[model samples]
Every structure is written in C-alpha cells, then in structure tokens.
Target: MPQITFLLPDGGTQTLEAGDAPTVMHLAIRHDLPGMPAECGGQLACATCMVDVPEDWRGRVPEASPDERDMIEDRIGSLPEGRRLCCQIAVTPALDGLVVRIPERQG
Candidate 1:
C-alpha cells in the first residue's frame, strides 16, 4: 500500500493510505477529499480530477500520455508542468508518499 497526500484547495492537507485503490483519483473519491469532483469517474473524458504534482515528485510519476496531455490542454488552454489527471496515475508501492495539490476548481 502507498500513502498519498492531497493538498486541498481550502489550504488543508489530507494524507490517506491508498490501500488497494487502483489510481490516485480512486483514492481521492474514496475519501471524499475536497476539490476532486471526478464527475466522469476514472475515465479519461472529464478533466475534473486534475491535480498538480510537486516538482520533487514529478520524476516518480509516469509522464502523461499524449492523449492525456491533449485533454488537459484543451480544458485549461495550456498544460502546466505539474498538472495531471489523477485518474491516469496508477497506484503502486513505488508511489508511496506521493503528494499532489488539488486545484481550486475542476475543469
């Protein structure tokens, strides 16, 4: 199991044990963390599950797929270096202690 930390929009931090969750989005939705609406669930359709990965942990997470990058660009007009759709990030032991900041609003 990996531990994922969410930096919420309200300036609060939430750390949760990711247990058997398949992805970061699943863990967020499971915990009902603020700022993660995930309206389209884990599908790649909605960009509602966006989160900003800190620079220090960026290398630990996989690079976003081309399609994922396009979707984010389409929604936000431009892709920031750390912005990612949590649904696309698979949970694994390698990602223990991963930290992501939730945007103030979903796309």
Candidate 2:
C-alpha cells in the first residue's frame, strides 16, 4: 500500500494507506479527512478537492487535464506551481510517500 500524507491548512498532518481508489478524493472521503469536500465526487466538475502536491512529488504525478486546469483557473483564479485537484489524482505505487497540502478553502 502507498502511504499518502496530507498537510492540512490548520498545520495538522494526516497519513493513510492508499488502496484501490484511483483518486485522492476517494481516499480522503473514505478516511473522512476534513480538508477535502470533493463536491463533485471525484469528477473534474468541482475544484473543492484541491490539494498542493509537494515540490518533490509534483513531477511524479500526472498533469491536470485541460478541463481540470480550466476549472482551477476559473474557480481559484490563481494556480500555484503545485496546485492539483485531488479528484484527478490516482493513488499509484509511484506516489508512495506523497505529501500534499490541503488549502483552507476550496470555494
């Protein structure tokens, strides 16, 4: 199992085992993590599941699709170099020990 770590906005940290779920949103929801709302239920339709992939892991992860990028641009207005929608991320073996930061708000 891949170990995924989440750095919450409150300066708290959470780690969990990444199982069969393809997206981080699924893992967050499964574990009842508070930082991610995932309003669109792992769909690219919502930006509420945004997470900041740490610099070291960013290049290892997949890039956002054009539609996901548009949503981030439209909803967030500003995109950080590490910005990512958790719904679009798959929990892969290569992502083991991945660290992510949860934004304060996803609105």
Candidate 3:
C-alpha cells in the first residue's frame, strides 16, 4: 500500500493507506476525505480532482498527460506548480510517503 499525505488549505493533514483503486482521486473518495468531490469521476473532463504534488515528490509520480496538460492550461484556478489531476495518476509503491496538497478550490 502507498501511504499518502494530503495537506488541506486549512493547514491540516490526513494520511491514508491506499491500494485499491489506482488514482489518488479514488483513494480520497474511498476515505470520504473532505473536499474530494471527483465530480468528473476520474475523467479528465473535470478539474475537481486537482492535487499538488510537492517538488520533492514529483519524480516519484508520473507526469501529467497531454489532455491533463490542456485542462490545467484551460481551467481557471487549476492546480499550480506540481499540480496534477488525481484521476490521471495511479497508485504505485514508488509513491509511498507521497505528500500532496489540495487546492483551496477546484472546478
């Protein structure tokens, strides 16, 4: 299982052990983590599942896809540096101890 740390805008953190679904969005939704709407249901069509991976943790995770890149460029208030669509990333052991920050607001 990958242990992920989610940092909220309010200066709080929630750590979870995730292994079932592949994406971070799935993990958040599974735990009913506050603010994880996943309105698009893992589709790149929505920006509601944006999360920011820390600079140090970036290499441990996969880079965004071309579609995801376009979404970030197109959507307002999209995730900033190190931001990624949770739906676009999968759960992997390499991401263990990953720390990601949720934007104050998402699509």
CA-lDDT, candidates in order: 0.94, 0.87, 0.83
Model 3, runs deviating above 4 Å: 77-79
Ranking 1 against 3 by lDDT, winner = 1
Tens-digit per-residue lDDT, 1-107, candidate 1: 79999999999999999998999999999999988888888889989999999999999999999989998999999999999999999999999999999999876
Candidate closest to the true structure, highest lDDT: 1
Question: Residues 1-107, candidate 2, lDDT per residue (tens digit)?
Answer: 99898888899889999889787889888988887888889768878999888888888999888888888889979777889899899888988899998899885
Candidate 3 residue-wise lDDT at 26: 93
Model 3 per-residue lDDT at 49: 86
Which candidate ranks first by TM-score, i.e. highest?
1
TM-score (all chains, Cα) for each model: 0.97, 0.94, 0.91
Q: Which of the predicted structures, 1 or 3, would earn the higher TM-score when compared with the native?
A: 1
